[model samples]
Target: MNLPGHFHQAQYPKRARWFMAIVWALITVKCGVVWWAMPHWNMPTHPIWVVGPTLIFATLVTILWLAHREE
Candidate 1:
């Protein structure tokens, strides 16, 4: 027995799941990069400065990718 038809229209959950997956992947990859860079990070005086912009760039790219797909 089926319920109301409108219940199936909310696609927010699907998008949310995708968004969460992307976030997790991004975090995991980002951590890996930082881990690999740990030695250089210790040597460079301005290392934190480098990672900040890179993270912003990567996040924007992921945002664009997801936004276009959902449309």
Candidate 2:
């Protein structure tokens, strides 16, 4: 059986796209720093606990953004 999907043509503003890209890049860099520094610090919490969600969300958003059609 084929299910109907709602597909709307949307255009993301250039400024917004650039802003999001910068934000995502910053988050990724922060995560990387945390990953590297976790071993040096005597922190109780694991690095994954702090960085995993951010990375996952950023990755998902990036993927969705890339998949979007710009026309």
Worst 10 residues of 2 by lDDT: 1-10
Q: What TM-score goes with each of the models?
A: 0.41, 0.61
lDDT of 2 by residue, 3-69 (tens): 2254333455778778987997899899999988887787888899889998898888766765666
| Global lDDT of model 2 | 0.76
Cα displacement (angstroms), candidate 2, residue 44, comes to 2.3
C-alpha displacement of 2 in model 1, angstroms?
A: 28
Clashing pairs in 2: none
Model 1 pairs whose backbones collide: none
Winner by TM-score? 2
Query: Candidate 2: where are CA atoms >4 Å away?
Result: 1-10, 59-71
- Residue 69 Cα positional deviation in candidate 1, in Å, after optimal superposition: 27
